[model samples]
Target: MSIYRKDIYVFDGDRPVKALIRSYTEADFEGLIRIQQESFPPPFSPELWWNEEQLGNHVRLFPEGALCVEIEGELAASMTGMLVNYNPGDPDHSWVEMTDAGYICNHLADGNTLYVVDIGARPAYRKLGLGKWLMLSMYEVVVRLNLQRLLGGGRLPGYDRVADEMSAQDYVQAVIEGKLKDPVLTFLLRCGRTPVRLMADYLDDEESHNYAMLMEWRNPFLPQES
Candidate 1:
């Protein structure tokens, strides 16, 4: 049985001898599913992730150079991120896929930024600097793509009286641990990303309102190539 655990390697002083980051591919489908399912409470469906991993859509993670780590050829940890996209490619007037670029356009004005919709590691692999490594990896992706910034969403369980005193980080944490608050906004701050909006309010009955937190890369001015 393939044990997909602790597959990610952070740039620790020790350096990882047993794990390393690997480019995501179709071959990783089954193992990736197993790892992700075990990582998130409601893991993304295998079919959904497989299609997104390959950009089998006019919108999604298809054009991303995402990376995951494995040990002994077993999927242990993964980071689902993206590179900048000018257009999803319209050789025949094709619609662009909804990757980082689309996510930013949906919230921020047209600009050069890479949005990291999600970045997660298994609980078992926590505190191993995987999160920091993932951030560095994201930085590399941003620089390589000449992206000016990185943006992402911090989803909450909508708005409820229980959240009346909740903070952004609290909401993000809630999503991760099912009891903690959101973490996106705070993590972004630590990653050199800045918050743009922080509004809270009530929602219609039953439906929860997302106290969305929008953040942008510190420097929105990437030097253009001569």
Candidate 2:
């Protein structure tokens, strides 16, 4: 079955550019890396970007979990994920631990949670609806697979500005209260994910002070625990 497909618009320059959302393939590996490069430029370690081996693993392990948006044959955005038996009791986890350093080696086929490894768009495509569409597409996967929820560690990219003034918990509370806006966290919130808790050393992002927020979007159809 096809992962997802839809017509979308990317507000790049003077006009809205037409785009298509669909499951990515092995052929798009280089394009995906380019998207990451543009999304996270220099100062963001190049070694952290998706490599050929990781992309190969993603396609081989869970092809349906890899989705991307393309503009006239150009890959503009992507979101990669895999299933896992999530443990709610232990919510604290680093990106490296969960994602297996982006290779997603721990993916469990029968797991109830679809854990997102990464989601990003090219610089020019940022703030557009592309990211949201990519997220929604993954949510669709949760429904199709009859999973419990979608989970991920989202960066608090705007936290550093107030790091010395308040605690990470306080900062997350501010975002939840709508008193502040974070580049990454705010976007995830807007996409319907509920904040779980603030996680420390989640990533190496200086802007986030290496903090992240564990977020989740529950499957509405999941049966209540009996």
Clash count per candidate: 21, 0
Off by over 4 Å in 2: 1-3, 9-16, 224-226
Worst 10 residues of 1 by lDDT: 87-96
Q: Which ten residues in a row have the lowest lDDT in candidate 2?
A: 1-10
lDDT of each residue in 1-226, candidate 2, tens digit only: 4556778776756688888989888899999999999988766668789999999888888887999998888888999999889868875889999989999888898898999999989987675678998999899899989999999999887888898999999999998899999988899989999888888998887788888899999998987442
Off by over 4 Å in 1: 1-17, 42-64, 82-111, 156-162, 166-182, 199-209, 218-226
Q: Give each model's whole-structure lDDT.
A: 0.47, 0.87
Per-residue lDDT over 1-226 for candidate 1, one digit per residue giving the tens place of the 0 to 100 score: 1111224444436666466665566666566556655654532223323333332221233334355665555666665544443322212111123342223223232336565644556665654555656666666666655666565544343434455676545655454454533344445556665555444431111223535554555333465332
Error of 2 at 167 (Å): 1.1
Candidate 1 has a TM-score of 0.57
User: Among these predicted structures, which one has the highest lDDT?
Assistant: 2
